[model samples]
Target chain A: MSDFTRDEIHRLALLARLEFTDEQADAFAQQLTQILHYVETLNGLDTTGVEPTSHALALHSVMRDDEPRPSLSNAEALANAPEQEAGCFRVPPIIQEL
Target chain B: MTDAPAYATLKELQRSLEAGECSSRELTQALLDRIEALDGKLGAFLRVTPDEALQQADAADAARRQGRRSPLLGIPLGLKDILCTRGVATTCASRILRDFIPPYDATAVARLRQAGAVFLGKLNMDEFAMGSSCEFSAWQPTRNPWDPTRIPGGSSGGSAAAVAAGFCPATLGTDTGGSIRQPAALCGVVGLKPTYGRVSRYGLIAFASSLDQIGPFARTVEDCALLLNAIAAQDPLDSTSAPVATSDYTECLGREIRGLRVGLPREYFIDGMEPAVEAAVRRAVADLAAQGAEIVEISLPHTEYAVAVYYICATAEASSNLARYDGAHYGYRAAGTRNIIEMYSRSRTEGFGEEVKRRIMLGTYVLSAGFYDAYYSKALKVRTLITRDFAEAFRQVDVIATPTTPGVAFRIGEKLDDPLQMYLSDIFTISANLAGIPGLSLPCGFTAEGLPIGLQLLAPAFEEARLLQVAHAYEQSHDWWRRRPELA
Candidate 1:
């Protein structure tokens, strides 16, 4: 059986950085429990010694030469900011004062 | 201009424009007027850019006068809202990016612009391309053009509806686990999800980076190929883009399918499928056989696990990709937050829809410390087995054929409350995305209730040319493409 409890879902929401109301969490927990149960069928497969396919293409470390090219200007980059100050994105205080 | 059938294919419009029967501006105006009349009922388009479209049309007309001709020149098309348009709002049908207008165009959109295609507007979709039905859209649910009470499949619901309702001749849609094909199937149009990396995903809002691919929706197979020719290209900006030569997809449309090998996957024709859908697909197979194509029975045993694997992989990627939407740089920011943590959490809570949140949570759970190996890694390993299943099957068959969807379009809100049931809607189409193969869905038949049924044709990776050829042969032999929904 899937073990998706409300508290587990709350922990996941915290990790995901999204706030969910109790009602939302409760409903999602139930649905997610059902989904987890459904996906648990994969455990029945004998995937021993099988390699994981992260991407369809097998290319590794696709890197271009270290060359600078045109990119979004500072004004354009800051254009979509909800709050901007001194030509930089303004955010809530990260380091709290003692 | 009024005499022109609004449901005319893109090729028909091209012919008319070339023959001087009507100017591009006149066609654009007529289509814009039609959208004004019909889209209110269909909810297919989130916005309509008449002024910009008309200006583009006028420029196309002048270029035509200067003896410059292109297949998509002066053609008006809608874009699934996920693609960023330079100065246009690129809402992925979510409240978060409700007013997020990008400063750049998606590479596909820019290529189409260069090919002279005119933009009608951004179309509706499942919020963040998360739902199979369009009902999850933050704006309004897009109704299927065939039947108003039914959903036009999604997250490309608006693109399919627009093509079906004749709001535009063609449109672009992204498929990550069947968004393009399912909707196209339901609406009786053609939708193609090219091989992953076949089309650049430079500016497409990520939904599942490995699986997401931008493709086209049109009334006919030929039109789909034409749109593909214009948009399929290698882009330096998208590192995953295959640096291979692009083909003129239209060149293969008229090719005969004689001596072609089509595989019927037994796993797809299982219980719970709508009888009408199965019957239509079986009939299509027979039709291809009659056209001198060989039919072979095949097995893709891992087909049942596609939904499970898809959910785990897609949600994991989506959880990571969507981390940028924390009310920091762009998109909607919630008010009344005490600290940065509260600000990030509250903004996402307010911005995303229930389905998006559900997937995000699921993704987080699978990728978490204790469950990572059990869920996410297991899913990735199963993904390899699934891909191997296709690779083995394709060695003996040129293309695999199946019913695009389990059933015809369901009524709005019919399956909304059941999330598991909703995920099963993409069972057949997900494997193609997972395996990185080209898949196309085209109208094959209609049910007794007059709902359209789709026949899916999937080709090996990068074998879109062969896939389109076989689909075109079947399409040319049928009268289904001639049928248009009577949208009152």
Candidate 2:
């Protein structure tokens, strides 16, 4: 089994913005390693000249007209907002700087 | 009601409607009532559109009165809440859009609406279709109708549960990986993930854009086919929708499976698969063989790498697709954000569930400056190998057969603590998504515990017709598709 350390797991958690306890982090480290090791079985293949297909079929080329359409009024749009101010969605200060 | 109409096949319901024994309004209200009765315990719907559904059912009854009827006419269906519906809440089961109503309808929604089908409301799902179990939804976990303590498989868990519970006759779901088929297999419903681009994705919230496709969840194979006929086709609005030939899928049903080469992947019968699932799947294969299908043991050697490669590629694409939800344009915005970064971070932090956030971070990491090739690019190369494996295997077999999941529905909290274990549940179904192949999950047998088990039938990409044919033949001989959850 691969040794996925607690530090690495914590780093990944940081990257992932997850607030995990130390115990949770340890568990995740072990689980992720096992899962990755299990999935490593795909490494044993010969994939020459086979094109990777992102979509099964070719999509239509046409684009819709960029015409103006009726839109939800600001009142209707924010009608369900948890919090709103001055016809806009209220939010915590975005950037402390800039 | 004669034998719980929810368990009846789409053809049976259509026949009943056509025979004038029951009006479309009656069926629609029956489902609405069913949802009202059980939704408190099941948590299947995020929103229930009783008034709108009644109005649409009246229209359908009027249309049928004039002898203008289609297979979908008067059918009551549910949306996965990920697809936009005009003036209806399309939350994607996230708090961000919990109250957000789209000003427009998705191509699939608009098509189904025009076909005279009634909407039963939005079904709960994983936040942004991210989790394999419905536990991840911001609302509440959708309980398996068969056993309330267990989860219905997910991120389309709500759709699968609703169909199995008879909350709606059928539902629309989006599969990006194994969201549709995996849950269907777990819940004992039929779910079809059409080959990518076969259906329009416009107005369906993006999860992993490259892997995502809108699909159907129904009570039986024929119902799935009927729904497919209504939804699948070219849509100019979605640039990625294929302009393919639209043949009625029902035409291919009820055909014999004689001479069809069914592939049994030696690799899919992996070490950890439960003995019960194995026995059930083997019995399905034997039954298919009895029905004159030739079972071939085909080896797709690269099957093992599917989960990792799918995670990497899917996450990378998701990172890009979800960048649109950065609190700028639409969706939920966290309050008191004075600046841009705080606005983006706080909105995302508040709006997305833990699983969705984790995916976004993993996706962001894989697509970041230094590690793209090691993770994303290499995964793409591995994806190519996996696809080639399917192509090579299909050369000898017309379709593939496998146990849809490693085991039947585990308890709701069984794997919730371990995300990796949850991810492994999709292993059998993900490769088809990776290869952009069409796959279906149909009820084959019940687990020894009496929960339903599903056998997955996979067809080469765009070969939905063949998949339906195989499923139809199986349904004819074995009437397991008629089984329903006995709710007290």
Of the candidates shown, which would achieve the greatest DockQ relative to the real structure? 1
List where candidate 2 sits over 4 angstroms from the true fold.
A1-98, B1-4
Candidate 1 chain B: worst-modelled 10 consecutive residues by lDDT: B1-10
DockQ for each candidate? 0.84, 0.33
* Residue A14 C-alpha lDDT in model 2: 50
Q: With candidate 2 superimposed using the best TM-score fit, by how many Å does residue A18's alpha carbon deviate from the native?
A: 7.9
Which residue pairs collide, candidate 1? Answer: none
The global Cα lDDT (0 to 1) of model 2 is 0.83
**Residue A49 CA error for candidate 1 (Å)?**
0.8
Off by over 4 Å in 1: B1-5
TM-score of each: 0.99, 0.91
- Supply candidate 1's per-residue lDDT for B355: 93
lDDT of candidate 1 over B193-291, digit per residue (tens): 999999999999999999999999998999999999988988888999987788888889888888999999999998999999999999999999999
Model 2 CA lDDT for position B343: 68
Report every candidate's CA lDDT. 0.93, 0.83
Model 2 Cα lDDT, one tens digit per residue, B26-126? 88878777777778998989899999999999999999999897887887889998999998878898887766878789999999999998998998999
